[model samples]
Target: MMIGSSNKRLMSDINVTPFVDVMLVLLIIFMVTAPMMVQGVNVSLPETTAQPLPSEKEHLIVTIDQKGQVHISNYPVAMESLRHKLSKILEGRSDREVYLRADKKIPYGNVVKVMAEIKAAGVEKLGMVTVPIDETPADR
Candidate 1:
């Protein structure tokens, strides 16, 4: 028997177990964080049966919390200056549309007041964001 001709064969197969484990870990991390990535002021939206609007472009969002505090995107804006802030923000944008999300617990008058201010800001279109009514029998 030749000394250099042993029966051991070189292992050519790639070990994919570690790669699969890493991928699974990344998948789990994304799954856990996906919902939280949609960051916004937390508010309980009222349910509506209206059809969802089709959005062609990103629109500025105005939010009102349960305490009736107004916010542009995530930043708080005073009611006294809401119109001014909106005017300046919309001056350069052609869409001039703003979506309002107000807590259902807030009084309707507060929502109307916010809407009035939004209109005063020269916004051409104002959309109300609402949760769709659940049609599932289990929910009823």
Candidate 2:
């Protein structure tokens, strides 16, 4: 019988496949929940058949609740200060566009008044945000 001694070393390479898999799983979870995680002022938007607006850049969102309360980017602003506040927010922005999201239950006069204030704040373009009308027919 012959006995031989061989030199063998343990593996030094780290296995990163598990780490990469966990990272990818976390990324997918965040991506799936990202849209649902967006917090904003609550308002039931009116339905409309109007065409969607061309959006090339971000626009300041002005929301009005059912109680006639005004909010600029989720922060509540008094009606009297809306113009100045909006102007301050829009300063240095060249787009000069604002989108209004108001509750459908609000009076038309209040909406018009808010629009006037937005216009007075030097907003060149004012866009109204509305939910799309469903065209499906109901069966009798």
Candidate 3:
């Protein structure tokens, strides 16, 4: 009787291909959904020919929906108490600038009322957020 023994060492190198594939998939998923994660009060801004504001620093945002609802950031605020709430939010802040975004369907009177409240809150500069109008060379 003869016994034969074959010598073969087991593979020791770790496979990193799966790890890299998983990381790439996660990156793609985040990129695809990142814009959807931006939290803010939704409003259809009016179109204008005004230039876009330069973003030098963060400013507080006040949103007014078509239903005449006021919101500070993402929280809902009563129109009557808008001034007090804004004052609280702007307490001790040197830059008294606030950006207002209101739906195009909102009435002019409502917007003016909201603006008055903002002014009463001691906001020095008021910025109205509007969608830029696209113009062709022929329109210019």
Candidate 4:
């Protein structure tokens, strides 16, 4: 065998097969976990025909479940302390806006009580969150 004529050759091309495999795995993982990532208190919202309001930034959301438990985001808050908690949360915020989500089965009086507490906290604007009315053919 000649000294300079070796069978082994230098490989300058990159092996992209492993990279593509890793990327596909990551994509599948995200797809599988995406729907499970939705975070909120479960409540059957009242249906409405009103247009949805545009959201520019993250705002405070107060939710009341069917069992009448109050929540700020995902944390539970007692009705008695709602005003104090809201005030403390909005102490430095300029907008002082809040959104309320209540179960449709909840009594109107309970909803009014929560609204009163929100107003007492000095909130400037209060928005109600409702589900859009379904326009499916079967419903009609």
Q: Report, for all candidates in order, the number of backbone clashes.
A: 0, 0, 0, 0
Query: Please, what are the lDDT tens digits per residue for candidate 1 over residues 14-111?
Result: 99999999999999999999998777797888888998888687889999998899999889999999999999999999788999999999999999
Q: Which stretches of candidate 3 lie over 4 Å from their true place?
A: 1-37, 135-140
What are the clashing pairs of model 2?
none
| Greater-lDDT candidate between 3 and 4 | 4
Among all windows of ten consecutive residues in candidate 4, which has the lowest summed lDDT? Answer: 131-140
Whole-structure CA lDDT of model 2: 0.89
The per-residue C-alpha lDDT of model 1 at residue 136 equals 49
Best by TM-score: 4
Task: Give a tens-digit lDDT track for model 2, residues 1-140.
Answer: 44685658888999999999999999999999999767778788888899777778777999999889999988899999999999998997878999999999999999999999999999999989987787332310
Tens digit per residue, CA lDDT, model 3, 49-131: 99986787777999998788999886889988999989988897888999999999999999999999999999999999888
List TM-score per model, in order.
0.68, 0.67, 0.68, 0.69
What are the clashing pairs of model 4?
Answer: none
Cα RMSD for candidates in order = 5.8, 5.3, 5.7, 4.9
Write model 4 residue lDDT over 1-140, tens digit each, in one string.
Answer: 67788778898999999999999999999999998776678888888999888878998999999999999987899999999999999998988999999999999999999999999999999999987797443442
Error of 2 at 7 (Å): 33
